[model samples]
Target: MAERAAEKAYYRFLVLFFNCLLTFGSYFCFDIPSVLQEQFQGNLSCPNGTHYNGTGHNGTTECVEGLGMTPEEYNLLYAIYAWTNALVVIVAGFLIDKLGNRFGVFVFSFLTVLGSSVFALGSHFRGTPYLLPLMLTGRLLFGSGNGSLTIVQNRITAIWFKGKELALAFGLTLSFSRLGSVLNFFFTQQFESRFGIQWTLWGGTLLCVLGFVSAVTVSVLDKVGMKQLGLDGVIQQESKKVRVQDVRQLPLRYWLLVLTIMFFYNGVFPFVADASKFIQDKYPGYSQREAAYIAGAVYDSSLILSAAIGILIDYVGLRGLFAVGCAVLTLPAFALLAFTFVPPLVSTIWLGITYSFAAASMWPSIPLVVPQATLGTAMGLATSVQMIGIGLSNVIVGKILGTKSSELKIPLWRWQNMMVFMLANTIACIIVAVSLNIIDKKEGGTLNRSTKRSPTEQVAGQPADTASLLNDVDDERSIN
Candidate 1:
């Protein structure tokens, strides 16, 4: 019996490992395009150039010159992508609860593949203005898949690991996902530089296919494991009950917390996507490709370190971890923007570490407060709030750069504006962290008060080793 139990546990681990891999693979698809957008601009010839101008207008390249769209139009494209992703997060939470993780993974994987296929097709037909609409459609579909995968992956972790092991399992899962993001940053740029923009899109499409296959395989394994355990009927009954609950009315406080975290994390993505351009523009000596590489390195480094930070949080608790993360991030935010004259290597390394710590600290803290049953919903709500912040930040930053006096001819100031935004975000996060710490301390104090009783009181409440008499005493007390 013991051996069988051990074997079952091993298989469960295998299922979770593969599911995590699939979730990570899906993120690669989401990230590839943002990194490759500049290359895409070169191929299509928009008068606005492929690069984002902080103003609302696309650059004045041949393809987009007569399109009558502003940089804002292009910016809206990204906003739509972010908002769609947020919507999917909300939907995915409910769907995961209703459909079960296995079915949810399979469905979302198919949706993701379909979305990636559309995106690839749009990229191939870049000459057509209509392709823009197709691209948005693809993003919407991709969001659904991404959102579903997010919930299912968490559910898998919760089911497979429990008690002390749960935190470590979650940390490792996050680390793998971050690795995927790192790959997306570098590989997308490398592929675009080497083979042109179309290949980058195609690469994302291929990743989606791989993710789908892996998800399906894991689902099959999970079902077989369930039957072998002789708990298939119980699993079905629980799944049916899960499908009946209405999760939309979860408390406003939960949504607020989710939004606050998400909004602050926006700095990580936009910075990664545009850092190369910002760096090259600010420092005239550097090439665009070099800048992009630096930016990618920052993202990869941040993600690689996030896993370590998550484990640290499990040991030190959320308050200390959050305060440390915020403090670390504040340094780079100031250093990069305020001290623009520093060497690229020095700036990149600090910024990467800061970014890594912020993300690692924030993500792992989610499970500590959120109830296990509604973690997916909470995550979705939080992600949605974060997307709103990202969209606003992207637009505001773009506007600041667009409106800058062309007369100044300085690129460093553009990055300075971004730095100011990062600083503000960091401050907000810090305030929240401090508040959370205080709350945790108060709660801990209260719990200790409730649990700790005098030795005399404990003795008075129970008989010493007279098991039969103890039952009689308890019965007499109840009768009284």
Candidate 2:
């Protein structure tokens, strides 16, 4: 029995580790162009275009250094991804539920790798007329895979962690995934500085290949666990097939939660996507390296604290209260970044805290309200809605910032558009979160229960369920 337990433990950790790796490449590659914003926007190649002063700390923004693309073109790279995923994720979710997350993971991971290669290929021919078209094409593919894989991650995570440590597992996965974002911000510049644009991008693409490998490994591990550990019933229960008609059964709170997710994410992710350039435009005195690292703090702080916050919420079970708090905290962060010249680190740290807090709390709440059978479809619907907000936000942001003249020494006006959009979203989030909390209370406080199960609740070392790899955990928890 001890040996059997050890095997289970081993498979569990391995699957979780590889599952976390599945998103690393996608996150890292997503932000590459933003990190190299200057390089991509440059009109001239770096052979003599833009260079560090003799001190190696300051760069001449006066020099145009890379592909001669306008700001609107630069922002299109991100907007395309959001637009494509707004629809694809819903279909992907249904497929995951009908088929299984394991297949979803492998297939989408491959799509990301393919997308990365396409993106790299586009960047390789920097001077060609085809450059922008190729790049946008690449982003479209990448977005489809990235959004779908995220749903897969959530579904599999629900199955694997279930009632116990669900929040922490999410936090850990988030921390690991965001680590890619952090790395891209910090290293993409360094890679470009040493290797030039084409190679640096291809280097990031190589990481996508690694993510695909991890996906393959995780699928194998998941399959092995099912066979060796008697987890077939668990898989069937958690990932049971469902039809579109079943979506009508999702609760009112789920829709509210989806609204909250949509509004809340719009404030954060689009901000991050454009952060590096936003920093340089606001603080012209800083080097690209400084701007990139400062931008990175938004993700770095989350990577450091997300799991710890998850553990706390798991033990205490006040995710709704924390959800409200998370939205509230973001208000000031957006306020400071938009209005004051105060050091950006303060605002970024605040945004990071809120991002980590919500990652731990708001997301795990989805399983509580939605039935297990349709969790995939539910996640898909939420993600589709979330992408709609993000996509529209990106389009708005691109339009506002894209038209600005590159001649300005400091474009202070740049922050206002993002701030107005984010502030409005935060206000919306606060209202929605409050509603979710009130309604959750009326619905018996399902989201407020500690996820820890009593010994009496254990059955076959996993939560028992119906149409739910996720519901069994919910089944054992009482609202009181």
Candidate 3:
């Protein structure tokens, strides 16, 4: 019996770990444009005597004279993903809840693969009239799949690790996802310069396929494990039909969590979309490759720190406060990057720390506020709002650059303006986080409170030793 219990514990974590691979593609694809931005805006020297240099970061590069499109057009590629995702996530979340994880993951994984393929094809037709529309269509399809990938992963974690180990599960998954982002920065340029742009996109295509395989594998294991553990029937019973009116049923704390997600991510994701280019433009001497490496440092730190912070949150139980602190830090971090001569690396480190803290504390907080039944709907809603912020911010940043005086050939001032925009976002986040903490205090500190099950509750439907074993596993935490 003891051996059986140990095996169950091991499989629980194994299944959760497998689920993390699903987001590898989405995370990788999301940042691919950042590394390739320089090349996209650069011109290919054809047989003609004219030299068409792709639009530089200043956003004023003439598209008609060069690579058939402008810098603003290239900028649209990133925003398209966010805008499409913002819309798709709500529907995908509902489907995941109604159809179950396996079906949802399977279908979306295929879409991701298809999108990547289309995107790769677009690169091959670079100078053609068809190129821009094809790439945008591909991104639209990719966004449809990528949007729900995170929400599904969260639902899986909540289902498998809820009531104990929830925060750590989320942290580990996020860490792995950020690792994909880190790897993109590290390898995107290498592949592009070594093989070509088409190959670089194909690299992302390969990752998408791998992520799909991971999702399918986990789906099978989850089904088998649920049956073996005899929790299948319980879970089935717990599943409910989510309704539109249910939004009204959520508490003030849940909405606050949503707002916090929106404001904080608005400060994070859009900034990342432009990080590599921003680095190059800000420091004129830095090469594109060096700028990519510097921008990637932020993801690197998040890759290393996310899981550790998650573990710390599990033990310390001050999630709300940690989130607030991280939000406040974003102001100074972006300020230093924009307003001062501080090394870009230094700003990235601070921003990376802030990023990890927000993710580690924020995601896990969702399960506490919503019931297990409606977890999918709640996650979807939050993700939709977050994506809207991300989408709009990308467009706004590009517009800001476009408005600058065209005579300033090197628009170093644009980076400063971008930083100002991010700083304002962080300021808004601080206000939201403070409000969330106050509400947490009123709600008996749910945000910081670790759960404890009653003696009767712990053993109500399980073997005596089995119940105790699970409790022992979570012993580091209070028994709630």
Candidate 4:
């Protein structure tokens, strides 16, 4: 019995380690440009008092300035990633459902590696006319693969850690991914200076390779586990493909949650794309490294906060209320950044906390409102919708910042406009959260209530199979 327990714990950790690896590279590459923003656009230095020439001690401009792209163009690099993700994520999700998690993650990891390679090569395209186009292509490929990674991760996590443990698992997964983002901010710029921009980009490619290797190993483990449990048919059965028309069968709560995800993420990630630059522009006294850390402070905080929030949600079952609270706090967090004299670090930490809260509540709620068979599709659809908002919003903010922008200074009013838009997005998310709460109450109050059956089991109207369900009773008794 002791030996069996030890083996079980080891397998669970192995599965999670690979699952987390799947997104580690994605998150790391996502923030690479932001971390190296100063390297791209040069640094702001105020050596003599609060007013000095904008030129800094940092050496050699990289992509954004080297290519001579406007703030809009620089932002387009980030925007293209989301735009491509919006286009491909749903299809990728469908494929994952059909092909299984292992294959799905493997394919996407390869795409990430190839895309990062192309992106790195594009830096050398500076002398050629195809610089922007090549980089855009690389970003699109990267985004295409990246968009589906999280969905696949969630699907695998549900398969392994369903029920009371699901939320905590997700929180742990998020912390792992956010670790990549945090480390990117901490090290990418330093890497660029010590090595080169190309080497830094290639580092992302290497991380994807590590993720791919882990994924292959996990796939084998998944198969072994299924066979050991005498549930080898479970994966094939769950792959019963979803059709386009079946989307209508998704409950209203699921769609509402989707909208909340779209609006809520738009409020956060678009701002994140611009955050390093925003800090450099607003707080000239700080160095590029200092700005990267501050910009990433929100993500840094999530490393610890997300798992705790997830556990709290699992214990209390106030997913909607927690989401609403996240949205509400976002208003002041952005307000502090936009209008107040409060240090950006304070507002950033607040925003990070709220973002973590929303994420913890939001991800776990998907499985509750949809059948297990459709989990991948639901996650994919949500990601696609959310990425659409993020892509468009990034461009909008970029254009706003680019408007009448001087080489040396960006006026506070331009940033004010961007803040207003973000604030409005959060407000819209709040309204959606309230409506979702009302609908959840009217439907069954499942978001805040415990049950004796998995939502999937209820949806299928079938008795839970002990062999197939992975301790289904424990899962059924909890809500996130």
lDDT of each: 0.59, 0.80, 0.77, 0.77
Candidate 4 lDDT over residue span 1-480, tens digit each: 532431375777678887888888878988887876544443222233232122354632222233345577678888999988887988887778777887787788778878888888887666568877888898998888888778888988877766546678889999999999999989987887777677898888888777777678777777676666544565676686556666678889999999999999998998887787677677646666777889899898899798897777767768888888889988999988888767789988889999999888888888777877777888888999998999899989988887443253466788888989999999999999999999998876767653234656443542331112654423444642
The regions of model 2 sitting more than 4 angstroms off are: 1-7, 45-48, 52-61, 237-241, 404-410, 453-480
Query: How high is each candidate's TM-score?
Result: 0.78, 0.91, 0.88, 0.89
Q: Can you tell me which runs of candidate 3 are displaced by over 4 Å?
A: 1-7, 44-69, 403-410, 451-480
lDDT of 2: 0.80
In model 2, where is the ten-residue run with the lowest total lDDT? 458-467
lDDT of 1 by residue, 174-204 (tens): 6677677778766666666567666777777
Ranking by lDDT: 2, 3, 4, 1
The number of residue pairs in model 4 that clash at the backbone is 1
Q: What are the runs in model 4 whose C-alpha is more than 4 Å off?
A: 1-9, 41-65, 403-408, 450-468, 471-480
- Please identify which of the two predictions, 1 or 4, would achieve the higher TM-score against the true structure: 4
Candidate 2 vs candidate 4: which has greater lDDT? 2
The global Cα lDDT (0 to 1) of model 1 is: 0.59
lDDT of 2 at 133: 89
Q: Tell me the tens digit of each residue's lDDT in model 2 across 1-480.
A: 643551455656667899999999899999998788777777655566566321122433456567766777777788789888888999999999888878899889988988888888898677788898898888989999999999999887887776667888899899989999999988888888888888987888899898899888888877766655555565566565578998888888899889988889999988887777777667546677888888889899999999899889888888888989999989999998898888887888889989999888988888777767788888999989999898888878878775554331335686677788889999999999999889988876767766675534433332322123434433544442
Model 3 agreement with the true structure over 1-480: per-residue lDDT tens digits: 642442466888988778889988778987888877766655544344432222344544432122334556766887898888889888888777767788777888888998988988888787788888889999999988888888888988887876567778888898888989999988888777767778888889999999999989988988887666555565555555566577688789989998998999998887887787777666555666777888888899999998888878877778899989999878888988888877798888888999999998998888777766677888988988888888888888878777332222337687788889998888888899999999989866777754334535434532221133334434524554
